[model samples]
Target chain A: MSYKAIQLIKRPSGDLTPDIFATVELPRPVLEEGQFLVRQTHMSLDPAMRTWLQEREDSYIEPVQVGEVMRSYGVGEVVESRNPDYPAGARVIGITGWAEYVLGNADMQVVDPAIDPEALLSVFYMTGLTAYVGLIRIGRPKAGETLVVSGAAGSVGSLVGQIAKAEGMRVVGIAGSDEKCRWLEEELGFDKAINYKSDNLGGQLDEACPNGIDLYYENTGGVIQPLVFERMNRFGRIVVCGMISEYNRDQPTPGPSWVDINLKALRVEGFVVVDHQDKAQEATEALAGYLQNGQLRFRTQVLEGLDSAIDGLSMLFRGDNTGKLLVRI
Target chain B: MSYKAIQLIKRPSGDLTPDIFATVELPRPVLEEGQFLVRQTHMSLDPAMRTWLQEREDSYIEPVQVGEVMRSYGVGEVVESRNPDYPAGARVIGITGWAEYVLGNADMQVVDPAIDPEALLSVFYMTGLTAYVGLIRIGRPKAGETLVVSGAAGSVGSLVGQIAKAEGMRVVGIAGSDEKCRWLEEELGFDKAINYKSDNLGGQLDEACPNGIDLYYENTGGVIQPLVFERMNRFGRIVVCGMISEYNRDQPTPGPSWVDINLKALRVEGFVVVDHQDKAQEATEALAGYLQNGQLRFRTQVLEGLDSAIDGLSMLFRGDNTGKLLVRI
Candidate 1:
């Protein structure tokens, strides 16, 4: 059997265009001992994808080289296996690259959804884990404290605000669109939402969080950060999950003078979720509980077909998507 | 008896002129029960004194009001006593206004000379405690880590760099003059010293601390800070002790950008020495041990008489003093 996949054919200059990626066909590898093949079901299209696409010097996790299969994390089902770790029929989650079928060693640990069928997608692994670690673990939101999450309506930031609200914190989200802002406050129970594009960001933020922000889950870093830094209270902590705002810019745009950081005494830490692998299971379990209890809700903007990965990723850079965008294969 | 005293007649505008302070005569304070009179011996002149002189809308502490006897920390010997806590002829170190004599409560703590005589003037209380707490307790310098101290030849910065070097970490010092920088490297055993006035600060910093700054003792703010922030390693801790460079400036100068903090992920905290009073005795004793063992040395530039207090303090603002500035009355 042969599998179709999207591969990186060219590196991008400023923004990712359709010509940057090329789709190709290849014969599927035969499963060896302790090896399995998986048919990709759902692949995450995150703002971080845009960062990886850039062939520049940044804090990105290495750029996608030309002629290589595009890298991604996906949920897939095992189609064939000659391994003891996974059977021929099982659902698994791992770094299944941008392809319809994936061949990997069975030793790559995966969660079997057979035992607990109701383990929702939000709890499956990465999505929920990113939310859990980014909030309770990194942000350390305390009850009655104010939490301002940028990109608040997106996958990681959305769950971050919801979890902060659950912790009894006053959650304020900043999204690009008025609709996303409304959804955050009205549906997600965020205390308030400020549309970063239309609203007076600094003024609205001050009004929304009168006590000053305690924890800032920073997913967007650019002009918004200076505004947030100015109003931060003493001992405020910022967790840098991603900086989607600076991904597509052509020139090196310097961030504004936030000298208020030293004046206010703030702790800003940058973290990647993959570094916290030890707590992956615990994070997934807790987030799943929230999902089952209907305490948390997220929207998945599903883009059909594996070929749409590039366009789906571009949605993040353009700030078009309202939630966790997934390319359904 | 009457004693001559200097009162803060007015807050100085841009510079400290003679009119800013007024010499006054006050009836010597009577020794009540549990109180003693001490003839002032030495007064410590600090940059914090000038900071207290400025009027701030949101002042951290109340500014020294007009017509008030200036507050200072001094060493004196009790001449008369009516209290059991302190006997006549005992040496004490405590808060004493800028006066020839002071009548203080018997509750005033006695300085233990034998514990370590170096501490009585150098290591026991303010400057010593500032260095001890700011370097050990606050900055938390580790072995093999690079520690950078701005204003390195000054009172607190000098001790911090020396202490960091003693802890097996490489130490770099940034002082105002070539003479001071040379003294820091030669007399204090600092690994590297750069004259902020003569050398390119950013270039010198990069060359001196090639591994990058892990712990920064931030004393000089404004232009120096942005340069320091750029070279700081990830998870670097910055202990904001004082901003002497910007303290005397009349206008509100802009500080470093939040991008410097956001990208590097630094922890910047400002701490008052009084807040860490609980550990003062322990830190003082340890620092005294190092002094007695010839592991630590404190340099002082002493000017004689109460009238020289203003001049001694002026040396701090001008960055003329190489070590702790003291007024020997």
Candidate 2:
């Protein structure tokens, strides 16, 4: 059988586009022992996928090579299975590609059918777990403390703000648009939301966080980082989850302002969820409980087909999506 | 009842100079209800004194006014006492000024008489405790790990290297001079010493630390900072104690490349020794044991008169001090 798949034609410079990615017809693999055939259902579009496309081997994951199937994580439905564990009709997720179908072994991670599939694919699996681990495990935010979250309208930042708020912290968010800022404050229960694109971002942030920022959940890392870095309290903690602001730049982006970190004796740490698979279930249960109790809210923006995956991922860099941007194959 | 003192005549721009300070004769302070007179014997000179000179109100300690006695830590001999805790003939230490005499109460912390006075002034009081707390408490470095210390020839850096070496970590020292580097390697038992003034610092560091740096004791934050910052191993820890290189600058002098901090997932923390005085005796005894056992080596550059205090402090910002810079009253 033949299926269509997206192949990377050339290494990208700033942003991934349709030109660098070409659709190619490939023969479907014949299943072996403990293998299953999965028809692609949903493809996850994330900022980290941008890191995977870099032509460097030193990154957390190996860079995608020219003419290779675009490396991605996705959810699929098992159509045929040789193993009882992954019987036909079961849903699975893993490093599934931007393709119509996948023929793989038990290495296909099973997705729990109990949770909402949209939330599971977008937040609970990776982005939501990243927020949980970074905010609770690493940042260790305290009650009544002030928390400032960057990219507050995006997937990870939105969850991080709600989590901090649920923990009794006074939560403030920084987002790109006034509408996103309004959603963060009004819908997500953020104490305050500052528009990063505004001219008076520094002043608005200073007024919002009067006691100084105790915890900073950093997502977008170029312009807002220095402003928040200066306002951090003595012994503040920073969770460096993403830097979408500088992901497109060819050169190494300078910093998140080390002077404040050193001067205030602050703690700055970056984490990748791929390294912490052990906490996936724990974070999912905690997040699910919050979701069921109506204490947490998540938004997903689904784009149709694998053809839009390249452009969907670019939307993350430009702050185009209001929520978790995904592709429904 | 008269004594001479170093007085600040004007706020300094770059390096402090003798003209900005004038030695003036003044009447000795009279004892209060719970006060005793202390003949200041030794005044401590540290990189932090430069911070006190800043004309700002937001620092850890209150800034010294333009016409006040230079704020410093000093050791004194109790000449007249009104309290048994600080009896006559006893040696005491505290935040005494750059004066020949100090009238103090029980707040005048008494230093143990035996642990070499120079060592007491330099290490036991602030610098040594800073090194111990930062390396052991904050860095939490494990044995068999690699440690790279900046300003390895200076007071705190010297202690940090010996302490890391004692804990079985491979120690690499970075200093400004060949002579200082040799002393760190030959006298202090550092495994490697890289002169930061060398033409190829990155190449030298790469060769010396094949395992990559696991812990960095950052005392000098200038050009060498970014170089070492890039070579940090994953989950590396940086103990930010002082930034002597930028102490003389009128404006913020850029940064030490923070992109490396996030990329490597490093933990960078700065500390004030005064904040950790509770760990003083513990660190002092641990340090003294090493000193008595000949496991550690210390040096003190004693400036002869109070008049040389400006030049001595200036020497620190210029990286001219080869050891613990001090002033003898």
Candidate 3:
């Protein structure tokens, strides 16, 4: 009859704080004709949530308004359905809020019930689609070209580096820690992984990418951005996927000068996965092929309950989560 | 016979000084088997010439050596020819140095002698091609969209605004002086023109582009860059054509943060006209059509003789030129 949900009480200033969100219990909604009820099983916590919390009018998607249940992508099952399209017991994936029970909308897709929810959320959903779209479609990485990805140990970055490697690119990753760097190089098959916290990041990048960076997958926008930007070869492509490092700051860091961008003939593009839903089937098929060949590997850092998502979101900013951050309801 | 030329005696540091160049008389070249002699009548002074003077290894083309003649684009008449492709009295357009006469290379294109040299350099040569490629091809602007062009009075920027207007787009121009702004709005058919040097540039831009900027043709990247960048609408495209404002500096100014780029799904692209030669014919035909329809208008600030070019080059940096800067010998 009732379900617990996290509601955004205050908009974040710099860093996310506990006071910004309030956990509350809400009555389950009665489904009308053509509407279905979904019991959310796993909700993804992403860096993009920071943008959704902002009060900006010009964001790609409408920001989650204050006093509203926080928005997220999740996998759920239809507990009760008035819509024949989503029969009871059918699994679905779509925009589900931080709640145990939600009234599913037309946007929700009925997915195979047999696929593991972790794999569904990690590889076959927004996480995998973002990486595929950013790297393959936007980046257009070529074989023998060098690809440098920031936040290489995180979900999208990890997938991007691995996908670049799968496409026969020389993949170099930049992560926050040496342990993550080792994981990227050894586990993800990256050609080289440099720790951004280490000394002489420019030098490390130079040494790693002797041929210069041809494609740069930008997830983190700290020291790695300018350094990799300077080393980009002529006609390089930079996929501005996420600037996770600058999400909490009031004034984000300035980007590299446009002079080099002009002189080097570089293309810097940004895209959100939701805008490219038409390519979802193609991306999923390609990612599934890679997954079947064992070229794709993913790890999940799951929190216990719905309430955990409030604090779990901050873990992404702090770079605490090892892989995909999710809240298992 | 001897002709006057300007040689880059030393590399410039910040502002270009007259002492950096040495005016000298050189003997006209005798035509070789495949070479032809060109009597350059009108040498174009472009902002891209500043980059040609820099000794960077990664520049789009090879930089002029310290002891070499300053590189430029010019329209000339072939006085003597050994090549069948270029006969004597044939008007040619291509890379020519700051000289009265030079040997023609294979890159030079023989133009119809009937076309005015000023018209060729201003709207049908590299200047026109650069504008056409950057705006139409890269920006992919649609009808009813807003286009804001920095350096709106300059050769390429002026053409870019006119072409956008011809394509049925709302055109806004950013220039340094009020006179140039007036010229843009009145003579060039720009919907609105803002003087970037005036107080409250951001407010002026907001007032000018009520619908927000969709395509930004960046020629000067100083105060106007961040202002236009901040006002870009969702899916906006920024064509980084030239950074004339930052070209003479020891350290170019940093660009706006790329956060908005990612959040709004923006595409920032930079290109050199030389790289897109395949589209030259298409651009020429399109530009010629605009010229025939009286849609494109141009102004030239012509300097007298090759010797004036040494001091005349500084006018571009000072924003002193009314339109396209050219040297008539």
TM-score of each: 0.87, 0.96, 0.98
Worst ten-residue run, lDDT, model 2 chain B? B255-264
Please give, for residues B25-99, the per-residue lDDT of candidate 3 as tens digits. Answer: 888776669889998999999888888888785778998998888999998999998999999999999999999
Better of 1 and 2 by TM-score: 2
DockQ of 1: 0.32
lDDT values for all models: 0.77, 0.83, 0.91
Residues B1-329, candidate 2: write the lDDT tens digits: 79988888888888777688888888987776677988988888898888788765235778888889888888889998877788898889888888888777556787668756787876677887888999999999899999999999999999999988989999999998999998998899999999888898999999999998899888888888888887888788988887877777776666643444545577788777777889988998888787787878889999988777878888887888879988888
Compared with the true structure, model 2 gives a TM-score of 0.96
Ranking by TM-score: 3, 2, 1
Candidate 3: tens digits of C-alpha lDDT, residues A66-98: 899999999999999899999999999999999
Per-residue CA lDDT of model 1 for A167-212, tens digit only, reads: 8999999998989989998899999999888757788887999998
Per-candidate TM-score, first chain only? 0.92, 0.96, 0.98
Select the stronger candidate by DockQ from 1 and 2: 2
- The numbered model that scores best in DockQ is 3
Work out candidate 2's RMSD over C-alphas. Answer: 1.8
lDDT of 1: 0.77
Which 10-residue span in candidate 3 chain A carries the lowest summed lDDT?
A52-61
Candidate order (lDDT): 3, 2, 1
Q: How well is candidate 2 docked (DockQ)?
A: 0.49
The list of candidate 3 runs beyond 4 A from truth reads none
State the displacement of the C-alpha of residue B79, model 2, in Å, after optimal TM-score superposition: 0.6
